[model samples]
Target: MLKNDQKVFVLLENNNPQVESLSKQLEIPLITQKQIDSHRDGFFLAWRDNKLALFDIKSPKKGMSVEFDARSMEQPSWPAPKTGTLAQAIGKKTKTVVDATAGWGQDSFHVFRMGYQIVSIERSKIMAALLGDGFERLGNQSWIQQLNLKSPKLIVGNAIEILQNLEYIPDCIYLDPMFPAKRKKSALAKKPLVVLKGIVGEDEDKKDLFACALQVAGKRVVVKSPNYAEPLGGKPDLSFAGKLVRYDVYFKT
Candidate 1:
């Protein structure tokens, strides 16, 4: 269930069967573009340029989608070189990864493009639905089809429980749980993150989630956190730093 005070609806602007099906699948109300005025205070899921996008009521014209191509400007190649701080934290030998907190799935997709087999878990049904739609689009891409590559498997559930029950333990368990903003108001935060925070709230049980990851991961547990926040599990055995974020790694002995 979504947090109280957060209202979401599916906007069906046309008679597209797929969009209608998505509305039914999400169990959210299907509203037409004309009906936007009536639901002026709610967020909406709508198809834009054939891609499913999430739109805030305040800025209905501007929406965000789970985009794979957007990163191409910065990383012009497919399966981008595994040479960043993130890759360092994940380790060169890690082959399989479980993204235990796949909110918008950006990190999960990045790891997938880096050539690691990945399984993504998200507890929020709405986010999971968006992820499913994105992965479906990714599968239909020309390169993906040519290479027979599949998008990361998405599991809709609580990671704390799901990690314990995975059929095979992954080499690494990745955590990027949400933390409260440093300021009293989050108006300065990115629009997508602000909307996500409004919908899913914060990851209040990150400590417990971290403990579960440590127990389930075969090689190590890597946690991504804002630089200002304390390590989730006391101290990490190793830490890798990015511009504004940090990856804390706990190796399994």
Candidate 2:
């Protein structure tokens, strides 16, 4: 049975003593939920430890709906230009783009709106579920009803494991991995942070992810990084500047 208490607890598995200890240290209650038995065919309903949503165990590549209300509750100021933006750094000729680290599908959705076929890849199972739910709602919007635009494709798995196996080679590849903040004071409040923190922990293997992305993009790769962060691949051949962010562009030449 689900915990009825309003105060959230840190849910854990019986085998994870370290996690349980961490939960206790944080002053959060630790609750354990029963994992449903899988059928002979290897299918079982996916569920969250404390969350109410009935999350199906499916990769984001399969598709899902995101709540419009939740997306509306938070906003991130996207960089746009008077003429062209960082998105166009790969050039207007490019069509298909893959977001290698599609944490919450924000960047992927923006690229989809820009008349490109986007393949969004999110690695974490929980993040993928949230993204899947969001995409489901996004696909059925009234505006989508009038425009008849197809939804962006979603792929859930370690990007390093999936990118090289893709059947299609995208014209542009995009990456925006989580980076350590320069100072705790500069951190911005993002709605996805709480859930993502629980699922992703920390990104310790970004170097491997970058190598995989470099192997997959056909024409170019674009990486979004903070102004103070180092370039993704040494110095990019070209770069676009924003107020607090930068887009590093590497060409296939």
lDDT tens string, model 2, 134-194?
Answer: 6876776666655676567788788889988999888888988776666764556353543
Query: In candidate 2, which residue ranges exceed 4 Å CA deviation?
Result: 1-84, 185-191
Model 2 score (lDDT): 0.63
Measured with C-alpha atoms, the lDDT of residue 14 in candidate 2 is: 61
Supply every candidate's count of residue pairs whose N, Cα or C atoms clash at under 3 angstroms: 0, 11
Candidate 1 has an lDDT of: 0.85
Give the Cα-based TM-score of candidate 1 against the true structure. Answer: 0.91
Local error of candidate 2 at 86, Å?
A: 2.8
Please report, in order, the local distance difference test score of every candidate based on alpha carbons: 0.85, 0.63
TM-scores, each model vs. reference: 0.91, 0.68
